[model samples]
Target: MTSDLFDLTGKVAIVTGSSRGIGFAMAQALAEHGAKVVISSRKEDACTEAAKQICDAGGEAIGIPCNIVENDDLDNLVQKTKDAFGKVDILVCNAGISPFFGPATELPDDKFDLIMRANVRANIHLAKLVIPEMKERKDGVIIIISSVAVKKGNNTTAYSISKAAVDQLVRNLAVENSPDNIRVNAIAPGLIKTHFSRVLWENEEALNKRLSKVPMRRIGEPEDIAGVAVMLASKAGNWITGQTFFVDGGDTIDI
Candidate 1:
């Protein structure tokens, strides 16, 4: 039936950077929709807390601390998920870093490298590591969490470039994996109200300036992105692939 198309029962999902904020919200949403979720982050304590919150909500989740910047950590995370569950049915490459906030000229080279490694390289690494297993099974879904800044050419030059790379990564992977029945997509969110974007949303003057561009006339919540993530990971999106969905509350449209 139509309702069953979105059902995710028995599926196993791994959401990186899921200790809190958008990642946690997406993990919770997947769990609520009947998927076993792995909540991972750099801090074990934060991961544990997120797992507990999901469990309390009557969903199955396990905390696994993983620093995406480290390949060994990512390998351990994949191994632990296979050991704990059976397989990884879904992967949300949401772990990213944005340490700098100025123009590209003023941004430090080290910081720029950090952003490239964490936001762009890590996502490709994780996807490549998981592809063999998914190919063997001939089924899987990979979702990359991108930013609307890529489209708007935001002031965070390094971050925007990295995210744009992620968008292309999704497209390339989707093309490569489509014949194998694996789907890959990216979600570019606008100004979502989260700790990650607190500096932008918290400032009254900046918040109003940002809001004026969005026809929605408000900021987005983690839940807003979470729902879309659920849709992409479930059977409802089986026919969808190679797309960069802009969940920007009309910000991209206005600009």
Candidate 2:
């Protein structure tokens, strides 16, 4: 079974916010690698479409829509996955929102609350919901989609702060598990060209400014982060836990 190091055959995965962008790419990759994956997001239609793509590719997948901000939705998501797949082997908490973009000092309380609630608090809740089963099996992988903004700093203070807290969250969970078998980690991507980051990469001037700092001299694509998630979820990354893997194209290192 040495060749099975990266093989995910028969594993069940729940990837939140997987209707598009990084989440979709990771789900697709996991499915392709033989894991049964759930395509989930706020929009049922979008989730269905994403799931269809995976199934069409000869992968096992299902669509389950869930608004990550709602605790009930989170519960339903896990329950739905268990109902369909019998067990959860991997969980990707990739859904998040950043409603405001401005000076940290000027950030309004509502937006700050929204940002933290969506990005940080929600992940904690989802983890709480699924970790018990993982602990019982003594095996699991949780990957959080974080951002390089956590390290480089950004004008959008609330979003940046929330991601920083996520890195710490991964650390805390990984440490508490202490090589017990449930691995919790994160992926910190930089300047990816997706609808979610259009403001930073859409304009010629803005894109060039950000690209100049990246040693790779290019922005990342959703696929760029997908491979890392696959490795982490597979046995190849069993030894690694509670660390933030930077897929930043040298953005964090250049500085």
Candidate 3:
């Protein structure tokens, strides 16, 4: 028999930015756990391709292209999911951008705005759109994919700040939604080796510098964060909310 704590059968999940990387990994993990998932990204072709892969693996999935920065796109995404799957039991706000790279003082205004809009504002928009249904049913889970940079205070100032905002967003939503039985939390991941962060792990000097700081002595994998997403979406994490769980291979704890 399936354990009640982690059983996700019959659940419907909408995972944004899931065409590739960590977002795709989380969507796949949720599907494997029996949740009918909506795989979404900006590109329609990529979303369809990811959905096909999940279906081939014997998981129920659908593709929905959404650019999170647009309100109409996000609304359409939610509408499409509801229209296709009936209801959404889980919402993974994983679509984020980190275009700016440099010291805080050197950061450009446009890049800063883009990071905030994509990472912080987009997350808030999606959560607002999903929470009404979750509240009415008194059942739902919202998982935000944050970054360990908030804890370690990396030189990626704009990115770190945006993630920190997301962390606080989780806490705020969790506190407000607890009475409705809707849970919200965040996963702060360390240097995961994904296309989004290729600049860090692909560079020899940068990779070595980052590796030396981690107790695990190596970068993380996309699957590393995927497992945590599953746990949070499952009943195993029902009592957990309003917190940021760091999945950084002890990187934050190491001296």
Question: What lDDT would each prediction earn against the true structure?
Answer: 0.92, 0.91, 0.92
Residue-wise lDDT of candidate 2 within 91-129, one digit each (tens)? Answer: 999998888988888999999998999999999998998
Which candidate achieves the best lDDT against the true structure? Answer: 1
Instruction: Give the CA lDDT, 0 to 100, for residue 247 in model 2.
Output: 95
lDDT of 1 at 138: 97
The residue ranges of model 2 lying beyond 4 angstroms of the native Cα positions read: none
Please state the error at residue 108 of candidate 2 in Å.
1.0
Q: Candidate 3's residue-wise lDDT over 130-244, tens digit each?
A: 9999999999999998988897756788889999999999999999997899999999998898899998888889898878878998899989999889989998887899989
Model 2 lowest lDDT segment of ten: 173-182
**Clashes within 3 Å, all models in order:** 0, 0, 1
Candidate with more favorable, higher lDDT: 1 or 3? 1
Instruction: Work out the TM-score per prediction.
Output: 0.98, 0.97, 0.97
Error of 1 at 211 (Å): 0.6
Residues 42-107, model 1: lDDT tens digits:
999999999999999999999999999998999999999999998999999998889998877899
RMSD value for candidate 3: 1.3
